[model samples]
Target: MPKSLTTSEPNVLRPEDFDPPLKRKEPIVPYYWTLDEIATELGVTSRRVGYDITGYPPRKIQPSLKAYKAGSLFLVPDADALAYIQRFRERKKS
Candidate 1:
């Protein structure tokens, strides 16, 4: 009869050692919207929207007027607009 010897290694696994997939509600991706659509959604003039969110030197798509290209649409960041609104509201409350 042969006897088996156990090495000095731990049998349990730690949570940090296990590689679990990251769980998220939505994938992180950039979203773009046209100025007209954004104005309509927020119920404001396009010029006012641009002024309130981005002052001079507005964030633009910079499309080539000479030739039409696929996926040529440009947009400002929605989160930045939302943040502007939040700050505006805070100022109004004060």
Candidate 2:
């Protein structure tokens, strides 16, 4: 048999002898909330949510509240939705 290149025994496998284990990489995807989801959380109908998104009569218009359209579905970022909800609640208190 040819001489072993490593200092360890011919057949022995040691954890320390090998390189460090590779870490699992998680996919980086942004969180989004659908209009129905926001409506469900606020105990309202999706129609009302759409009105809020469009700043119709009765509801105060908020330019900062943004919604993105993907085909027939509209999506809002999690952070923006939470912020908008908080602001809406605060406005109601006034």
Candidate 3:
């Protein structure tokens, strides 16, 4: 007959008895801003931003302002939005 090792309490579980928990690696998500958000940040109306994108009379088209359409929603990538803002500032300076 094999002898079993005894514990102080047979019902209790010890931390040393199980393997350590795995460290979860978080995924890196890209940042994006909606047209409304961009307009709010730039202190402009959403319609003005739309005109900058699509080019209305008097307002020349800005091809650098890249916008992605997902269904009815428009999304601008963080980097692209920053670039567009920089360009707009330069245009205002000139």
Top-TM-score structure, candidate number: 3
Q: Give each model's clash number.
A: 0, 0, 0
Instruction: Return whichever of 1 and 2 wins on TM-score.
Output: 2
- Ten-residue region with minimum lDDT total, candidate 1: 61-70
lDDT of each: 0.40, 0.60, 0.57
In terms of lDDT, the poorest run of 10 residues in model 2 is 18-27
- Score residue 26 of candidate 1 by CA lDDT: 35
List candidate 3 segments past 4 Å from native.
Answer: 1-30, 57-64
| lDDT for residue 43 in candidate 2, whole number 0-100 | 64
Q: Please give, for residues 1-94, the per-residue lDDT of candidate 2 as tens digits.
A: 2348875655433223222321212212357777877676566688877876777755675545689888877788766766655555556679
Q: Write the per-residue lDDT of candidate 1 for residues 8-43, one digit (tens) a residue.
A: 553432213222311222322344334544455445
Cα lDDT for residue 4, model 1? 35
- Ranked by TM-score from best down, the candidates are 3, 2, 1
Relative to the unseen true structure, what is the Cα RMSD of model 3? 21.2
